[model samples]
Target chain A: MQREHEPNEHAHHGPDKPTYNLVFVALTVLMLLSVGTAYIELPDILHYGILLTLMSVKVGLVVAYYMHLKYDNPLFTWVFILPVLMGLAVVLSLQGLAGY
Target chain B: MNAAHTSVHGAEHGHGHSISNEQHNHMLKFGWWLYIASEVMIFSSLIAVFMLAKRLYPAEEEHLVLPLVAFNTFLLLTSSWMVVRGLVSIQRGDQVGLQRALMITVILGSIFLGIQIYEYNEFTHHGVTLTSSMYGSAFYIMTGFHGFHVFIGVLWALWAFFKALNGHYTAENNIGIELFGLYWHFVDVVWVVLFTLIYVM
Candidate 1:
């Protein structure tokens, strides 16, 4: 029983389950790194830097893989990313203006 | 969704007289992502507010239960993965698999909420009310809003699970779960940032 669909019913297929497993492992490891480094004595700049970097990587993985943006329409990337950048810009500008 | 059938013309989008199912699904996806995009603004604003408040308040250090919150984070991350698993199941036309995965996700999410409520109780006992200080107020507002989203996610997941139970989706027409998956994943992504800013940093 083949289900009937118009041509091009599915434009793309996302990562398979194994890829998801790999991503899960990577995310978990990244999180552990973030947690482990939180307790270490380090310069304020470097400590915050490391944590922010790790957090960014984790967010990228979740958005790209788990959310299937990598396989979805490119327009989706733009739609989702543009606002994120705007939000970042606002935060940065506020920080600069506030002198904190 | 392996059943064979003839093509019927037209779409519910109302832009044109007819449209393939694929077009309809794409429209749905576009609409949903647009909504998610709007949500990012509100959430990012909340994050910014908290970060700024943290700097201004300069309050005495309050020790939160790191281990407990960390465990809660693990639950949320795992539930996010579970949501994807359910989507994969539906894509493969395994309705039962999707149902079970959604159930697991729901349970994990519920547990996360329970732990958050319990932590709030503990904090309240320690005199950390919303009016305590800017730091406490920002913390409660930001995290409470996220908890509200998680609660909504749980409810949506349950609705999706029931939809699957009714065989409303098929291998080739599972935009329903797929869309839900995207929302759930976005929720998880928000938590990822929240964990870093609110807890770790």
Candidate 2:
């Protein structure tokens, strides 16, 4: 069997072609869902909640597959996600303090 | 070890036999991740400011045009997919496919920027300048910085396209394209958050 050339010690085997197409389609569907959600009339809390939930799912897909974080080293994932968590905390705290 | 000694060792060990390229690429990715982590903080601060401003002054909500921004969001999402396709093509040793995908990605990025410019013009015409109000200032600062990021990503994609045309990449060695994809996708993810927090919510 022929071994694939490893770009780095931490890099996994690259994703297959079909996986990219699948992710592309998934992202498109999520985009449409989020846009559709925006047009629906719901209570303020529920409306924002659904929008944010959909946004989070989209972000997860992009970061995991498109960015190859799922295939790369866990260290890199920590490097990327920690800051995002911190940002979320800070944003939420500020929003609370601002009386929103 | 000294530079001369290291070079001699590298030459003796040869390319694939040595771990130099692998280690170098790992370090490169690590550094890029660190840079992006810092960017996360910067954008977080901008988002915080925007939220606070909005809370303090509710009138800013009336100024946003959701439908136009939603269309812009779709363009960025499509461009992100194109960049991923470019990466996938190069991974499969399809240089022509990579080049075409990258060219399309750059065009899409440019169109997104053009729409943003038009949006800003509309805002300013409606007295939504930086000095207009706290809301206006926050709005421009957050989205403008994001626009600047998209512009930079487009330039990066253009460079990648030129490199692909010059046959600088191959199936086994295309770290440049991968790194560019990471950056472009990061910009896209940022926009997803911004669009949700600012436009939709």
DockQ (Cα-based) for each candidate: 0.47, 0.50
lDDT of 2 by residue, A1-100 (tens): 2334534423335565567677778877877787787678889888878888889999998998888888778999999989999998999998887773
DockQ, candidate 2, vs. native dimer: 0.50
Docking class of 1: acceptable
lDDT of each: 0.82, 0.83
lDDT of 1: 0.82
lDDT comparing candidate 2 with the true structure: 0.83
The best candidate in terms of DockQ? 2
* Candidate 2 local lDDT, B102-130, one digit each (tens): 99999989999999999889888878888
Candidate 1 off by > 4 Å: A1-12, B1-16, B58-61
Q: Whose TM-score is greatest here?
A: 1
Clashes of each: 10, 0
Model 1, residue A31: displacement in angstroms?
A: 0.8
TM-score for candidate 1, residues paired by index: 0.89
